[model samples]
Target: MNRSTNFVLAQILFVILLLTACSTEKTASDSEPKKKEPKKETVEKAPTEPEEMVKQGAGEHYEKVKDLEGDDLDKEIKELTKDFPKDMKSEDAYNRIIAAFAADHQLAFQELEDFDITFEEVEAYEKYSEEDGEEKKEGPLNVVILLDASGSMAGKVSGTDKMTAAKEALKKFAGGLPKDANVLLRVYGHKGSNDDKDKKLSCESTEVMYPLGAYDAGAFQQSLSKFKPTGWTPLAASIEAAEKDLQGKEGNNVVYIVSDGIETCDGNPIEAAKKLHKSNIQAKVNIIGFDVDNEGQQQLKAVAEAGGGEFQSVSSQKELFDEVESNWSKAMHDARINWSLSMDSSSVNWSSSGKGHSMRKVYSKMLDSISDEFELLRSVKMELYNQKKMTNEELDKLDKLIFSRYEKLREYSTNKHDAKQAALDKETDRVLKLIDENAENARVE
Candidate 1:
């Protein structure tokens, strides 16, 4: 119990207490439940054979059959598909083939569009003038009035003759026109009498009384007085003749046809109007049914639609005059804006010299080839299916061939497009700059 004995005893007791506390903590930890580690999720990557790769593989196979035709083509197809799995269902196999062909076709079209194939041709504007050689006002409004001087026009409408009403309306319309507008007066079916025997003469009676020129009120009135409604209606022939009358003239040309009846001379007015619409003259024809019946109005409406113009039904003189003036004003305004834009110096002129022209030609030819091939393949597939001569395996083989051809063409076009895009973009920028300058000038004017 001395000082040395007491120190040794205290050390032993402290060591025991530390050991007991460690053992108790370990027991408590072992009694509790252990937390389970979260299992790592394994995501399966999507099937690695991309459409592009499939197309590439198909393309290699396509080279073998591209040159084959007739029996040779059939023989090649049979040989290529001979190893296909026999257990595959026919419908399933057909669907797969169709899907592959569709993908390839889409890709081919996309690649083709990548090439800047648009040719920037410069527009040649012909300087129009009066017969006396004085240049017509340099605006874009050209109006042609087609008056129906047939027998029906002489018929009474709203306490006056249809012809009189039309004349008054036209005169009012002329007065409202802008000074810069060029106007023409064409009359049809005013030759022979409206008898069945004079049908031939009436049909061929189309004439341009007032040729395209500056609006001359006195001259147009004089021309109007000369025509009387004695002959049969010859609507179609007049339209056809009008196309020639405005042949070389440019700008927004509008034709206003005043009629009371349908064609009686076996001429197709709708067809004629369609031709005029699609012609290089860029004319729109508006039809005014002057006291016409339902049947006549319907036919006239069709003609107007074909000519890319509107149809107006007028029961009185006021409606006729109002419609004509409104349409003319609106059309002239639109034409002025359009003409200004077209004449802008920044617009692309496809006639320009350089690699652009050559590239356009090459791209055009490539497009034509691809189109022809596509059509040929489609026709062949359709023919075989219709004849029931093509088995599912054979169709699958053909699809592969199509896919390969498309893939090859796409690759070729893509390469060409990549090579030319930079140069094309530079040229485009130059054109755009010019357009911007022109637009500013137009706005200022």
Candidate 2:
């Protein structure tokens, strides 16, 4: 009844108390009667069409039909899509339908670059590429200005003498050429009077007053001052002289002739121009017929054609000055471009027009592709229905779906084109403005 009895009773009481607490915890308590319920887990519903699938588009459609056209296209398509899913369930199945018939929903910008078999090479070959010459290896540039110091050049035009006008233009041109370009000032027929007796001396007189070297303002001015118009024109002989000046020189070579008459020294100017513009010389001979008559214009124009150059006839001093300025600026542009490409591509090797045209071609192809896709889808759908592979309801649903995707693709392609076109136009304008600024800066007079 002492220690043992007391220990056993205490243990029994403790066990009873623990059991009572556990029982109370199982149900609502007096202090906090409300019992908390367990939270139910949520299950999210997936989207009908996945975004990644939409982005992927029915892009494979182009791959299948890209190599086919006309009846052959229809035949190949029918054969390929013979097993097209009749019961469209998964996103993949819908995408397959697009692949079989509809155009791709994703129109990439890379399609605009280079002449690939995927794109029609019409514009690539016909319009833009010809403007781009072959990549040429260059060493230096030679620009020769042929001044016709003939008696006819002493004549007046627009209140200014032809000779004086020619001198000012030549001075500005020679002084403004690119630093790397070598300029030769050639004066023809400056030795004799416009007399029949002095024809031999005048005809034979063609001198390179400012020898081939970098533009020298003072030296060029001195060269200009040393000559005066006093004899008959020696146009052909002058071309030959310029050819001699560029004999061993390399790179882009050019000759500009300021004349008022055709070759009167009995030399063939056209043949001379042909010789100068040969592949070996690679020289372009431009002729400016100042106050020339009809016969002189015809002859000079022919010479320019043979020389792979341009010809213009100016009856006024302003026209003459402008022609010279333009020719000089153009020549300098070519020299500066050493961009190693055609002058159209700009001096930095970016072809603004070319890129624009290519992009436009891409845009056009996109629209045509969309149209072609719609037609193919229509044909494929009708064939499926006729073969009992699909029902009317399925055809209608798929047609609507294909049309919707086509609309989105067209919108996407258009937006992309607009954005790229804006950038191309901006770049084009910038390059042209840069060229113009360069030209203005190069003008010394």
Candidate 3:
């Protein structure tokens, strides 16, 4: 052990001791509790698009005729007589002819909801002359004329401006209407408020330029001239409004909708129509699509179905005029639509198809029963409301009864029985007859 070696060893020992002390301090610090980190939260996202719905439809039918004399005949005739106008055109005559045919054949006509048409305009004009002043076989009608007024229609109609053209056609049609008939004029997408430029886009929205009534053709046309095409099309709102206008009015209410485009606003025209049908609004909707796209055609067709009427697609002004003329003709001649289902070349025979005759009859009966129940409930409610002396308690009771009945009705409808709604079916036929009779009697003078 020399003195130099011992000094080196001593230096090495001091270095080791210092390192051990630092390690001890680090271990002690690590033993203390530390703050925990938060877990990242996740949020769910909603679907960015709506599911697509199928656009399929099944055809419908009507028994156009009935000669069941006495009360039965009266009941059947009454069912067929509602919602008809006093004056109709040749085009409106088809419904009547079909009813007569149905009666003769003892069979019903199968029809698509959108295929209602008038056969021909009756030209005699003097058939409705008062003979001995006997209550001239009464024919009364209420018609709604919907005219298109989008910017596209700004030009002349049949050599006149679009608005003018409509007025002219309407005037001509009215010339053939009975003096006692009612007429309502509706113009859509016609004008825009000066204050807003955006509103101009939807200028073709609907407006009731005239309520249902007998009036001068010249005056009517002049009145219609005030409207100009400068906005967007609000077809749905227009239809809904028209339905509201005809809400509780008497006689047959016909909605003759004329348009160039589909609905462009926040409205469901088809749904509105269905509302009209389900509620038995006493209004039948007939649609004329004037130069539209496929989508527009579909929407219009749906609207017609909801209205329990038909849709007519027009490609040109001439076609539009022709359709109007034909409708007038049908109204006068009283043509009936004896709808029959010829076996579609691509499908099986109608009789042998999935639904048999007995099943159909059963379904029809069920529907009739349901309709009766609803009518009873509705009458009860209306009566209660009419009683001005009804107390709050009574009102509450009525409301409960209505709700309960409706709930039951919904349940039954969901059960899938192909029931015939008697009131609805009867009302549909009545409307057609009244319109035809009116057409036969309508006079320009």
For each candidate, give its TM-score against the true structure: 0.46, 0.49, 0.43
Model 1 agreement with the true structure over 25-101: per-residue lDDT tens digits:
99999999999998863322211233343243333245565666777766665555454344444344443333322
Error of 1 at 179 (Å): 1.6
Q: Which ranges of candidate 1 are over 4 A from the true structure?
A: 1-140, 337-445
- Write down the lDDT that model 3 would get: 0.52
Tens digits of per-residue lDDT for model 2, 1-445: 8999999999999999999998898654656766779786332222234233235445445577765778887777678767665654333334555544444535443464332222112222222345554443456677888989989888898898989988987787777777777888899989888799999999999998999898878888888888889997788888987887887875478888889988888999999999889857788888889999989899999999899887778888787777676544654554442442332334333344434554675688767866676777667666666556666666677677666656765676678678777766665565555445443322222
**Residue pairs in steric clash, candidate 2?**
none
Q: Write the residue-wise lDDT of candidate 3 on 74-161 in tens digits.
A: 4444444443333332223222322222111111112211122211222222333344323323235667777777676665545655
- Model 2 score (lDDT): 0.69
Whose lDDT is greatest here?
2
Q: Which runs of model 2 end up more than 4 angstroms from their true locations?
A: 1-137, 335-337, 340-445
Summing lDDT over every window of 10 consecutive residues in candidate 3, give the lowest-scoring window. Answer: 50-59
